[model samples]
Structures are given as C-alpha cells and as structure tokens.
Target chain A: MNYKTVLTVCPYCGCGCGMYLPVLDGQLGQPIPDKTHPLSEGRLCIKGWAASEHVVSPDRLTQPLVRTGDDLKQATWDEALDLVASRLMTLRDRHGPDSLAFLCSAKCTNEENYLLQKFARTTVGTNNVDHCARL
Target chain B: MNLPQEVLTEETRQIVSRLLRDNQVVGVIGLRTEHNHTGPHLFTSADDLKELTLEPRYPLATICQAILSSLSQGKLGVIVRGCDERALIEMAKLTNIEMERLVLIGLSCSEELARQCRCRRPYPSHIDVGEIVEGVSPLEDTQVRRLLEQNVEERLAFWQQEFARCIKCYGCRNICPVCICTECVLKEECWVERGQIPPELQFHLIRAYHIADKCVGCGACVAACPMEIPMTTFYTLVQEKLRELFDYEPGLDTKQKSPITTTLEETPLREL
Candidate 1:
C-alpha cells in the first residue's frame, strides 16, 4: 500500500534530466521521465531509464579489491589507498610522472574532480589528467 | 475552453475521498502535489485527498500494473486520462493487469492538450469529470503529413536520417505500456547487434511490427525519446495500415484480440 514516486535527477551524465524513481514498499523501481522538467521534458536516454539498476545490482562493487597473485581479494580502505599511493610513487620514481594517467568520472562531483586533477598535477607531478565526459 | 483547474481537482478529490472512505478501493492512484513537486502516489486514506492534483500526466497504467501484481486482493481506483484508459485496456488484453479489480475514474483531456499530442481520441469511453473535447487528427500534424507525402525513397531517406540520430537508447521500447515481453528480442545479439549506435533498420522495424497491432497512440515513446525523433508519425502510419487492412483499432476493447495475433477465421481481413 506504500507506493510513491520520488523525483530526482539522473546521475548518469551532465544533462541532469529530471526523473522519478517509483518506490513500492521501500523497493526502488524503474525510472520514469518527468514531464514538467524544462530540460528533458519527459524524455530520457537508455542510461536514465536504467539509472536505478546500479543501486540494487548484485554486480555492483561494494568494497575495494586488490590484486594479489593474479586474484583479487577484498581489502580495507586504508590498505587499498596505501597500496595505490605506494605503487604510484614507485612507478613515478622509476618511470616518470607522465607514465601515469588520471581518468575521472562524470559521476563525481565538480569538487571531487577538481581535487583529483589537483592531486595529479601537484602531488603526482603529472599533467595527464582526463575525464570520462571530456569527449 | 475547459473546466477550471480548481473545479476539476475539487471534483476528483471528492470522488477519491468517497472511494477511500467507503472502502470501495484500498488505495486510489493519482498524481499528488508534495513540496511543489507532482508525481504518482497511492492515496490509501481520505486525509491525503487535499494533495491530489492532476497535470503533467504519467503512464499510470504501468504503475497500476505494478501495484496490482503486488497486492493479493483489493479493488484499486485510478484516475485515468484517455491514454491511461487505453493503456489499461491493452494491458488487460495482454494479461498484464486485471480489469475486474480496477475502478476507472475517467478524466477527459482539454482541447489544447489533445492538440499538443495530436490525439485521435482524447476522451475516455466514460467521462467522470471534465468536458469531452473534440479529438485532433494526426493527419493535421505537419510532421505526420510530411512522412505521409513522401514516396518510398524519400521516406527511406527521411527515416535513415532520423534513425542515424538514435543513440540506441531503447527508451522508446522501455516506456511503451504494451511492450510486456520478459525477454525482449531487442537485447538478443542475433536480432540487434550489440555495441552499435544508430542500430540497423531492423531494430526499429522489428519493434514497429511487434507493437503495430497493440499501440494505443499514447505518445509515451515519443515523449521518452531523447533524440526528438518523431516516432508517433511512423507508428501512426502503421496503425492506419492496420485499420485499412483489418478494420480494427487497438485499446478500444479488452476482448478484441489483435487481428495480427488471431487466426484469419477469428479476424478476417477487410476487402480492399
């Protein structure tokens, strides 16, 4: 009996198409386009329609995994971050900072992307920073 | 031109409150305004009737099907426009919804809304509220007329250009109320090649043929397309052909099987 649709924006891209995610008994349903939205006007791409799938998908990554002996094992955040930092430092020291490239995602906030590029340029000393949405 | 917005809302609220108070329905499905945002809601009690406001229509029939399948018993009342009613009828025929457990509260559309959609039948069969306005003809739409006037080569060229803009989003298929296939052929690699933008003409052709007999002309597909493709123009042409060949219209009755799905004896072709 508890059925309602929650209005939200699509998280897939910058279009920020308004959509509604129907919730029945607390279970999220498919996305429906918002007719009154000025930008999309009830239109959605495939990504918008399937935006909710990732939230409940079993295949979604929940924790960091580190490769050890050709097998990936779950690791704590600290462990994963330390490993990544050490590897990047080692690679930069030996191969040079330009050898490593930083790729950011559209899903990240503007601030987060700015921090990443800043880290790549200042900390990592590499100018090879790109974003998935750059195209 | 039409009933004032407040008058329509008040009348609809009164009917919904009565239904909830009398226990005629467990919940009434309608658009509700909350925090200055409107979306579908299941109002189980009359206390929330004040929030009910109708505008910027959604595919309520699809939502109804989802709710009915979850609930074991209880009659559900839904505020339906002409397109919702047609979608429900089509869904009932496809075994996606149970018509017996539904109480239809028909709300006729305004002439302006009908004209915007180029709707052929803007009013439901039974009008519970609002004035019944004249339906707009799709032939009057310049886009539909442009397609109709084109010859085979010109039509192909036009569609090729349109289809080229397609990002293979599948929004058209996903938003369709009648497309209830659990295993869609559009996903199969054998039918539609994967990882290809501007999918082959077969992708559109297969979908057109699949829904040719069942389309209710709700314009949901057109509304869901991000590329602004005029899908209704193509589907309207197919619907006209179906009417010419079989003398049948979809979403009019639950008992009328699609002429394409039925045997020749059951649904004979009309004399050309």
Candidate 2:
C-alpha cells in the first residue's frame, strides 16, 4: 500500500544518468529512468537499471576487515586505519614510495577519490597512482 | 510452434514437489491449464499441484514477480526458458526479484517453438528436466539496417510510418524481458507526449537506446505488440553494436558483470 520513487544519479560511470529508485514496502524495487534528466533523457543501459543494487546488496561489505593469520577478521575503523597506515609506512620506508601503487576505485565518491589521490601524492609521495576507469 | 497440452515430465513434477517441500518457497510459478488455454499461474499449496502446467504459453516471469511481491521474504521456483532466464537475470540486477532465494527449473523449448521464437539458444546451459538442443538461428530481419542505410530524412520517414501504428499501450515496454522500470518514460507526458500520433521520433529512439546493451533479443516486445512493429530488429542491431563495441553478451554468464559497469582494468573485452 506504500510506494515511493527516490530520485538519484547513477554511479556506474561518469555519464551520471538520472534515475529513480522505486521503494515499495520499504524494499527497493527497481531503477526507473528519469524522463526529465538532461544527460540521458529517460534512457538507461543495463547498469542504470541496476544502479540501486549496491545500496542494499548482500554482497556489500558492511565493515572493514583486516587479514590476520590467513583469515579476515572484522576490525574497528581506528584499528583498521592504523594498521593500514603502519604497513604502508613500513613499505614506504623499506621499498621506497615508488614501490607502492594506488589503484582508484569506481565505488569511491568523487571527493573520496580526490582525497585518496591527494593522500597518495602528497602524503605517500608516489606518482604510481592509476584509475580503474582509464578506459 | 504448437504447444503441448501438458509437458511436465515425471522427473520435473517430482523436483517441483521436492523444491516446494524443501525450500521455504511459497509456490511455483509456471504455465497452468485454464479453460484449455495455458497461462501463467502460481501454485502455493500442495493441493494446487494439478494446476501447474508448462506448455503453450509462458508467463513465468510475470507470475513469479507477482507472487514474490505479494509474499513477504520467501523463496519461489520458476520455469525458465532462455528468455525467461535472461529476464530473471536482468530482474535480479534491478532488484525486482531476488535470485538467491528463487529456484530455477530450466526448460528447453522444442525446436519448432525455438524456431518460432527466433531463439538463439533455446536451451539453458544448465537444465533440470528438458533435453538440451542447439538453438535455432534467429531469422534475419534486414529492415532496421536497411533503414539505417537510408539518409536521416528517409530514416525519419520510415520510423515515422512504423511508429504511427503505436497506440502507446506500452505493450513493448511491458513485455520486454529487460524493461523492469515501474515508471517508464514512454508513459510520461513530457517525454513521449500523451495522445500523439506517430509518437515523436525520440520515443522509439530513446527506448531503443536505453535498452541497447541490455536487450536479450527475446522478441517478446514484438509478440506483445499489437502494431506488429519490428522491435527485434532494432534490439538486434543494438545487441550487435554492443558486442562490437564492448564484446559483451547478456545472460550468458551470470557471474561476470556487464562490461559497461566494470572498469577498463576489469573488463577483458576492453583489452581488445
């Protein structure tokens, strides 16, 4: 008896097609193309139809995990970030900054990616940074 | 293709019963014999077993979605053809149906039915009951390419004439295996423009462009279309173009993501 469509932009690519995530009974239904959007104008490829999936996907990682003794155990944010920083510093010290490479993710927010690149270049002092979307 | 009166083999029946008993699935959605015409139906209770039929008409997708939506979180079994399998995959991508909870009982269409549907692969790679056979080659429809070869003006005129018959029943969108949007743009007043003849050139163009890579070439749109519009040709062209550009095929591998979504590094086809 309850249904609503929440408008949002697709995150799959830089195309940024506008879409509506239909929520019925508090469950996500499907992505509805935004007829009025300028970029796509009510058109979506297969990815747009599936844009709402990652929001509530079962496969989505809810928390960060750190590998320990051949197994991954969930760790608090502070613990995980500290561990990452220490290991990265140790690698940078021994193997030099160029030894570490940064791989950009499509899943990260634009701001987050910018911050990551900034951290990699200014903090880590390495130009060995590449994007997953070079294609 | 002539549909059988009743086509469920004993093994299929047993599997269906076992799934219903074993899994928390509420029912099995498949064809049913009603008034001598097979149509899609949902069989939840065991007593409704006699009503299950897998012949003539195939409406498993519609029936399964309806049943799944009506019920709370639970499982359901569905009879799937190549088209149904593709529809289910696309639906799962859109979150319209949960693929994990749902059980698939694949059924290969008869060679004649496969031919009639212009099916590329009439059988599922994995099957539970039906015998596997190579799919009939899709009949060639050169009309779209022929239109493409025309000048823009001629192409416009041709499509104008073709789309003129569209009553805007949204049948093509409704029957499309990949068109899962609850609110379609074709129905919107601004995009398609309500109560217009020869619906603006953008109508068909936009819809075709939208489903270009996603279309599985099911021909359901053409079949549901009362106007007999050659939608398959457009989708086939789109499919071919997608393969050429991205080297991706829909529904063949459920594990692999669509090339469009994957990054260049992750996409094997992009290396080419």
Q: Which candidate comes out best when scored by TM-score?
A: 1
User: Per-residue lDDT for B123-187 in model 2, tens only?
Assistant: 76568766766675443435655765789798667767888877665656755667767677876
Provide DockQ values for all models, in the order shown: 0.60, 0.01
What is the CAPRI rating of model 2's predicted complex? incorrect
Tens-place lDDT digits, model 1, residues B188-227? 9999998999899999999988889888888888888889
Best by DockQ: 1
Per-model TM-score (chain A alone): 0.90, 0.87
Question: What lDDT tens digits, residue by residue, belong to model 2 across residues A51-133?
Answer: 77787899999999999999999999999999999999999999999999998877578898898889899999999888877
Model 1 C-alpha RMSD vs. true structure (Å) is 2.5
The list of candidate 1 runs beyond 4 A from truth reads A85-102, A114-129, B46-48
Docking verdict class for candidate 1: medium
Candidate 1 chain A, which ten residues in sequence have the lowest lDDT sum?
A32-41
Best by lDDT: 1
